[model samples]
Target: MTDKQRTDRGTREYRMGELAERAGITVRTLRFYRERGLIPPPRREGRIAWYDDHHLARLRTIAALLERGHTLSGIADLASAFDSGRDVGEVLGLGEPSEETPVRLTPEALSDYFEGETTAENLSAALDLGYLATDGDELVHISRRLLDVSSALVKEGVPLSAVLAAGREVRGHAEALASLFVELLRPHAAEGDLQRLRPLAKSVVDAELSLALDRRLRGS
Candidate 1:
């Protein structure tokens, strides 16, 4: 890998030995993690398994969790939960996420995404906020829309910290909106109806927020 590529944390394919070296783990430990289902199975090409950046990210996350006082079993569970999207879907009960795929960012890539606002303190804060999770050497964001919006705000001269703070406030409001919709739907709506009608809540919020912004800009 070139210096730029090595530092950028974008896509790269690796053999078993290379993956272990990149992740700073021994081959045996890598194998053990695979056995424990911490990392997904690699693509098979004949007899050789090919690992990718995703696997590397996961390995780095496991290491970070270990440093954070998580046992292997706990990390395993966390990995499984995140990978399965169960935490995002069920535990959070947020219904379908916005029409955006998850984003996996390396620390460096995340800096690039947020325009160098990714300080160590901010990173730790993001981890604490559950907005980010470490995987081997990458950060996993569960929502592409959120990542894009935060980065856009940073580009517009908003501080990353401020954006995150706003996100925290927005989370409360979002939960309230969700609860309102659920309660409103519960009496006559079936589960499928609840799912189908969820978007109406977001649409109402979006339209109202647009009008609010328009009024504010017009000094009304």
Candidate 2:
């Protein structure tokens, strides 16, 4: 805070016991955390040390995060993520977080395309696969890439069922690919290996996907 703001706010601070009560934690836990260097001690006035709401709020956040299975060190890493501006989701293993775009579709075209044959389950699965979306009671192909590929496959006499089967198989392959990397790294990767692993894994995955796409297109 600005010095003026701090002064105007009277440096509103709380003692260890008071802050821990406010944060729904035990004073002992807070003291232990301080001792472990997971949390820094408050500033002192003679013999008394005091904490502010910033510290209380941060502690509460840390507690919530720990309940979510994050280590104290992991919580510190997350707190630092704001300043670093790196892939927070990558660090959290929550995938690349992104905004969802609502795709539009029209019902009449969807009815014509599906011949009024699409089940609700099929429609939901199609949406999950980026194949279709609700466009006013019509399932609409939201992705031109998927539409084009499926069109070519249909022309080549491959049924939609076979295409869906292949999709499930590919998903299994992705799981296997992930397992392979985990096994490879489990024995020797030190802490903070994700930075090195991320680019390596991305490159390998992208290359594999590219070659797989080409192989599929060429009927291999």
Candidate 3:
């Protein structure tokens, strides 16, 4: 807002500079995003334009999708699709469902994360395991936890191939555990209640795993 442009009674307004600062982007970049239709048109008061919290939220969402390996064109398409009230499942076209946050990385960045272990064969294996999806020049890891754990294991001298094989085994056990918990909940709980109580299964698993580790360390 210009110094002359005061708040219009009910709605809060911010100047371009203020909006740019809030979004952590330069004015030039903000303008570029606007031109690309990545952000909505701001309300204009004569020559000055004013932005609001909605603009800030859109900017943050864009940043998150970018971090998750969406190209600008793809983000634009998603934004348009979401704005049009399309189903999220349709917009993504994901092969497998996942609740974990995805991590996006370039080929070089992926190599760095895995300590130079992102070989062609390992990449193929990851794709086959549904642990990775390609988005233009980026690779998106289906689960951030899996990506971090795999990278850490590689750093600890585990071969990438072995880590991937372990991941496959863990996937089978994880699915069985999930099925067991769902079966336990199906007859006794409402869907909403089951969703709310989902963390209980994780707590049980964590406790049991800890005890199992203790027993193994004690050779019992």
- Per-residue C-alpha lDDT of model 2 across residues 115-219, encoded as one tens digit per residue: 322333434455555445332222345445555665566557776656656766776887788788877776789757844675677689999889989999999
* TM-score, every prediction: 0.57, 0.34, 0.56
> What is the overall TM-score of model 1 with all chains considered together?
0.57
| Order of the predicted models by TM-score, top scorer first | 1, 3, 2
Candidates' lDDT values, in order?
0.72, 0.55, 0.72
Better TM-score candidate (2, 3): 3
Spell out the clash pairs found in candidate 2. none
Selected candidate, larger TM-score, 1 vs 3: 1
Colliding pairs, model 1: 57-135, 57-136, 59-136, 60-136, 61-134, 61-135, 61-136
Whose TM-score is higher: candidate 1's or candidate 2's? 1
Residues 116-190, candidate 3, lDDT per residue (tens digit)? Answer: 455556766777676776653356777788899888889899999999999999889999999999999989998
Error of 1 at 58 (Å): 12
Give model 3's TM-score versus the native structure.
Answer: 0.56
